[model samples]
Target: MKYQKVLIVLLTICFTGWVSLSCHTNESGGGELNDGLIGYWKLDGDGIDYSGNNLHAELIRSRKRPDSGSTNDTEHNDAWHQVSASSNLKMDDDFSISVWIDALSPDRDVSGDIISQYDVGRRKGFHLSLTTNPSPTGVGNSRRLSFGMDNNIASEWMDCGRPGQALLAFGLAEYNGDLYASTCEPEAGGAGHVYRYDSENNTWKDCGAPDRSNTVFALTEYKGALYAATGKYRVAGSSLPESENTQIGGRIFRYEGAENWVECGQLPGVEAIMGLVVYQGELYASSLYSPGLFKYEADNTWTRCSTPDGKRIQSFGVYDGHLFATSYDLGHVYRFDGTEWVDCDQVGQNNTQTYGFSVYQGELYVSSWPSGKVYAYEDIKQWRDVGRLGEELEVMGLIVYNGQLLGGTLPMAEAYRYQGDTTWQRMDQLDTTENVKYRRAWTMTEHAGRVYCSTLPSGHIYAYKAGETVAWRKSFPEGWHHVVVSKSANKLSLYVGGELVDQKSIPTSDSYHLSSGSPFNIGFGQHDVFQGRIKELRMYNRVLTKHQIDVLGSPD
Candidate 1:
């Protein structure tokens, strides 16, 4: 067997087997196989010659394709497989799944025998089309990994018309009542993509590719909004294929608590995206072409920094600094270089397919989308394959926060967060403002240890005192620009474009006056007094110096 040695080692993985039999897995499916191989046998034991078609099996992993970002390989891709009822793809309460697969060309014909539950003549259910190669759109080549619900199900399969070649297929899985899928490709020109099947309507909506010219590079759903990244340009119009695109660079889009996708802003200077991950604090996107990664500071503006040379960025997470990420196509882990991107000697490469990347317990983790294994590169060379998941688990956005590893699906509106233990939690329906009904937080900032989340589309700013919602908000001038606080003094001032508008003195001495609770928002702190986007805000404990106040109150 081509992978005989590796296959034996994989079959021995206890964690992989546990995932297959465990019922706790989240809806975004993918897991390893069990020892008995009764249920949905997760793709494990790499060398096993399942080519004989004796047992139904599935493989799940992340996707990690090349792009303009990192020269190194982060192995951030995921791959998985779905089998027939005989494959026993049922789950109980708690489980975790992961996998990796190098996709073949989309032109290759894959009969149900290679991926589905049926034999050559068995018309059991769905057909598996790995990659859509020689595609209509010349820009991005795509992969369609779908399954029909048995002959009775009428959903048509969007066949990619390719198979057996080393394309990238990460993984997919079903846990509890949720379902998850992923894919990986170059961040440039949106080569890789993903989609979601609305079981309620029996429809497959275009989750990633909004247009034909741009492919989906990264995707995630947070707080009810769906976030996706494309190769530096804004994508418009459906049905248009990426193959016709001429723009370079990348951009991120948001589907705010609604079905329609809205444009957020352009990704500063990023031309291509290798990986995207949310760690510690904010959203992070890496450029496959550029060594630098962009961090969402508040809204459109990003904190841009470059990675070490000889290595490109694949994925990112927050380890020690505010961020951490991996390099792909080249195998390495790149950490925040304080001022720029530097290689984290602490996190080196250990796996062959380093496609997907994340951070957990102050440790940097990388997943091999092709191999269907996850490796942790902490302080040494102890690389081990934790387990497997559904085939083609293309991990798009990997986040670790509040003691959990949150993974995102590319080209799809699915999100999953690991619940510390072995169980995975599905957060399919995020809080994208629908629950709020009226309030839509556009940006947030911290001042004097206090957090403030600004609500846009309504021009309201809400303040929190000691994490508790407060009743202070200040309205901005007619044209608010830099609504910032002075450095030396506690003065909140506003500057419209290149002119100072107003300067309000925050009573630092009189607790009673401060207790009265002024406006919590910068623009419109009082009533209909201010408008426009606030450029900046800062706060200090004491009164500011004349120079500091002037600086804060100075026009651009």
Candidate 2:
């Protein structure tokens, strides 16, 4: 369908169902589609509006579409159809624009513009386009839906945790009487596999693949069925282009009785969905594609809803009786206050990447990247810094268990129990061994009276029995580490060479005024004895910056 001067279908009028929109450019106010849709371009060969209105699309084909002369013949990166500034294209207080097109090349670096008159810097006009998407597994040619208005500043077409960085487990949920999670181990080509926790056996059993996809990112239960959102279409055992590790699309699947699963639908404009939630008796899903909120109506039936103030809607959770979601790029939170989505403000810090959302103690909390800190939601105006989980960058998965919230961290690939928003306790040594050593704890859930978790790299699930949490804190192996521990009436600081690594409050009155003994029997006197070899231990009368600590702790 190249350039035939064809009669293009411009969706103008509105309808009862958003999926079933009314768009006949024949005349304004003639059909339900009413936001003054002025111009229409057929791209058959011209930018003439078919609405009987004289407004025509301008010549701004940054990349022109070559005339194939027949639909069978295809054209690649021909050009873009566009219209200059027009009041008709401008958006109002509330509006929606829809389009129908066959995106040419998903491999194109610059996203293919579907429709828009947006001025990004001015942040005024609206834009809809087919943006390139690389699956979590590997980069492959793929295009997903993306849309945003100039007013919506954070409107980027794609988000995978962080820009250009691989994502951890994208989805997690509870089903039946057991907990289930999907693994996104792109490095091992173990994508799109599901695992079910068997508490009785204290292990995970592979649930197998839902379809031929890289990974499953979102899982939910609705109306007596287990639904899994899966995508990232890279061929197994093949290396994507070193330059572009683009992930493909994903689909929605339903557990068809016992172990069987069937396809129910796919995320609109996007191949995969980040998070899903049951709100007001309706199932809503968030996507980096169309980059907005969508409500599921039926199989293959979803309606687009509100747009967020950020680029990508990474995940969603219901908090304080309201549906709250996090936008990844801007690290901001938005809430559904029954009527529409309202900006609940953003997390303040260098970590602009917000990953998961969960509510604990009736308060809302979100996990972030790079900084690896969690923040508590008080209102749209303020967020309390809940502290860091460790030195991990991506605090990928977060869930509530045992009357407390648990978060999963990256690089270390471990889980931590949140304590009073001030301290965090290690969950356990679930990931023990080499090979799969550096994975992240992707998801944590409770099943059969136990906490079960899943991790990346290995893409395996493990169960945690009711017992004392382990404090297997290890020290820098033979190297110089600047470990700094600050002291209070009840606590003392622990520093390696110079860095403020960790701090714990141990009772007993004794300050380390000397560089001699095992520092009060490794402190806590009765807990245990030091098992590893120790070298230079220094007591500093002052705190040191990371750089100074590094220099002091350096082995060289």
Candidate 3:
């Protein structure tokens, strides 16, 4: 009986040791390397955390699809998995988040979050997403992967100097890592000129006028080259005296180099090229005064697409594999699926026109005229009025900057950042021109780590370096891609499929403590809900070495 008891004790000890070993081993039959792993979720059939950390996530408003490899399955924007905030999940200075995702093509012109734990109210924490629009410096492209973080501090606004004797910096675009602005210079011998911003010298280098028109209204990048659109902007629209320059400008031009432009022909029966956008590998342009929508075919060639109800369209955006346009007529929003235009109905009963569109936190928001109100898109023909921007009469430029939705208003020339439901906090009065009948904080773009806005009347470019974001600036490509984001010391690094794609340094003084109190999200955060399938999400409390990340990202 004594010998039998001793044998039982030995067996029990061996059994306990085997159980401990099994807990450390991953489901893929790997061990030892996942030492700092605090959470590992194999979202195969559920949100169970297999890291033995009990950090299981909860699915909220999520629906399972057959994984058809396209966005045609169903709307996944409302779905996400949430893990409760815990001590282990609160990252310090060094940490990493790695995941495998099969991102679906966006159904709207908006960025979608992959993984995040952010507090939009406080503007703190970190997020990884895919951008559907260009950044201010024009360094990154649409559909590029981006990672950003907010340190809970207000950024100082800097005046980036005026672009010539221009009344307005009409449009902004980025090309070849350089920032360019198109101006409406009504001064004598000051026809619309495109100026390149020299960041090192903090001055605008005149790239000469693309046309004799009074305004170079719009700018876009297409097929590795910069394109500019011209307009004979009616100053009367701003309650200002009409300019003597009567040069017609319904033409488009391609930038050749320093002080040179190549004519790309003119739009038939159109007076101004109001907006330009690239949708599904093709360039599309809108007419300012006419109900015309044309697609670029070749140099000096364009094909006219059917306009929505024969109504004029203005600002262009892309979402959900379709093109979206704000109307200069009827104030309605329209969606074009590369074939027919679907009327999205008017924004508000009192508003006369819609100016710009931005996607924030999985919903589309638009700025309106007359009412100066911003509306969030809910469903077909449905919009919820978020709020009005102070006492302004018109709201123009709308963009998602540093995890917040911001709008530029006319008359006051003020910029307001969204602060949740029906609440907006004024950031600043960008255009401080005294006694002007109408002043406008007109257009905006993101570049480097700053948000830049142009002002009418002042014609000055103002920039605020807010949160830091590093982007890949290229399409993320189809199929499952392994993505890893890591923060070590004062630098953020992004790795895709085991290769370092981009890296940027963060200020050491900035707060890197990522304990935002927000729940750790798997498919949702600051941007829209992810429209894709995610699996094998792992979070570590320490920076992962390149070799470790490579081994994990390698195809099985």
Question: Is 2 or 3 the stronger prediction by TM-score?
Answer: 3
Candidate 2 off by > 4 Å: 1-170, 185-191, 199-208, 233-247, 432-438, 467-556
Q: TM-score, each model?
A: 0.34, 0.49, 0.86
- Model 1 lDDT-worst window of ten: 132-141
TM-score of 3: 0.86
lDDT per residue (tens digit) for residues 1-556 in model 3: 9999999999999999998767635423565457788899988867899988899998876232221134421234556788998876877778888889887654334447788888877788888887555321121235557788876766767899999888888787656556789988875555989998888899999999988989888888777688888988888888877877888898889999999999987999988888887877788888988899889899899999999888998987765456778887878999888898888899999888998877677666788989999998766688899999888889888777667777789898898888988888888898888877999998787666567889989899998866677766455665789999988888988899988878988777777786888898887766667777788889888888887787678786
What is the Å distance of residue 542 in model 2 from its true position?
57
Best by lDDT: 3
Pitting candidate 1 against candidate 2, the one with the higher lDDT is 2
Off by over 4 Å in 3: 1-32, 62-78, 102-111, 134-141, 256-260, 473-481, 497-501
Query: What is the C-alpha lDDT profile of model 2 across 1-556, one tens digit per residue?
Result: 6433332322222223343433322222234222233333344555556645554544332111122122221121323333444334323322222222333221112223333342222323322322211112111111222222223222111111211112334544555444565655454444466666554554556676776556677676655466777666342312222212245545777776545778777765676666666655577676654475677788888887867643576576643345666776667777775567777676866777676765443345788877888887765657888888866666766654323457888767777767664678775544443653356676665443345555544445555533111110221122222232233334333343443333444334422221111111110011011112122222222333344444434544
| Alpha carbon lDDT of each predicted model | 0.33, 0.47, 0.79
Q: Who is ahead in TM-score, 1 or 2? A: 2
lDDT of 2: 0.47
Candidate 3 to native Cα RMSD, angstroms = 7.6
